[model samples]
Target: MNRLRTLLFSILFYGLSVPIVLSVPVSALFGRAAVVRHAHVWALMHRMLYRRVMGIRVRVEGVVPPGTYFFAAKHQAMFETLELQLLLGGPAMVIKRELSKLPFWGWAAMQYGGIVADREASAGALRSMMREAKALKAEGRSILIYPEGTRVSPGEQPPLQSGFAGLYRALGMPVIPVALDTGIVWPKQGAKRPGVVTIRLGEVIPAGLPREHIEARVHAAINTLDRG
Candidate 1:
């Protein structure tokens, strides 16, 4: 039954995404605001589909303060990607360069103001990321990044990628560490389970902290939702 539900939801999700993705070019004709508005609508649709079809509810435990701050979140499942878009009102995301190279979706992401960085490039990637991040900051938009770099199953504690610390120090903004257990209900590769996914926002870690201190705080804060 769960498998059937997952399959049905996946079909509807992607089926709907096709027209939305195709409309990216048309959306761009109207300008960036149009593109962003379309993206937000897409995220909201995914949230509705997840709730109605899969019975997965997303609950926020802590306050998500307003303003142009950095959002460091746990990467446990694809669910958070959509959830954050709705949660933060279309904050700019730091995504892989490869994703930006795709067809329609890639172009739409760029048009919608996503920052793409090459993870394999190490220091060079951080430099590129910092430059793009600064631009987003100038626009008064929040920056969303997964410090661990990739999705990890719940209960796993992977050290944050070095680039995260670099970006944090260079960006010079408060960091809001978001912890979540989305993997419990929405595993990376499996049937979606029906449950409440809690997203807890930790206290803001102010700017100018030492690299070690900031990294430590973010690492711990983002894992608070993981069950032992």
Candidate 2:
């Protein structure tokens, strides 16, 4: 049953994404609004697909906050990104630069105003990300970064990278700690499982909290949810 759902979801997803990918260049030629509107629709479609594919429902806790702020969200599965797209206003995702090279998906990402960061160059990447983040924030776009950097498999929390702290320090804005158990249903890089994915949004951690302290708290919050 899980495999059937996964197959059905994959078919529907690719079928839907192909038209969007093809239209990206046309959208670019026409106007930026085309891309934004299409992307927003895609987000809604993905949300429906997520629910149908995994038989999982997302329950968000607390307000996601209004206006531009850095979203220090935890990464357990790709589902988080889909949810982020729908809920996060003026969304600008911080994604791996490599994903920007993919054919269709890359064009769509670029068109939709996603931020791509090269993970290889330590200093250069950080500076570039911060610069882009600041510009995006200035434009009223909320930034989303997964402190874990990559998907954490079930029952594990990869060592929280200091990049997040560095970003928080540089940005000096309220960091909203998002805790979600995506692996409960999404299962990183595997067949979808049936269950519920709970996303808890904690109050925005005010600026001036030491970087390490903020990182620790974010880690602890996600870990607490993962363990539960």
What tens-digit string does per-residue lDDT give for candidate 1 at 62-111? 88777778899998988888889878767889898889999878888988
Among the numbered candidates, top TM-score falls to: 1
Model 2 weakest 10-residue run by lDDT: 27-36
Pairs that collide, model 2: none
lDDT of 2 at 211: 67
| Local lDDT at 15 for model 1 | 96
lDDT of each: 0.87, 0.77
Q: lDDT by residue for model 2 over 1-228, one digit each (tens)? A: 899898899899889978867877777776655677777777788888878675778887878756567777778777788777776664778888889889778867877777767767489888987887777667667778888888887678776676777778877788777888887777767688777777888777887787678878888776768752
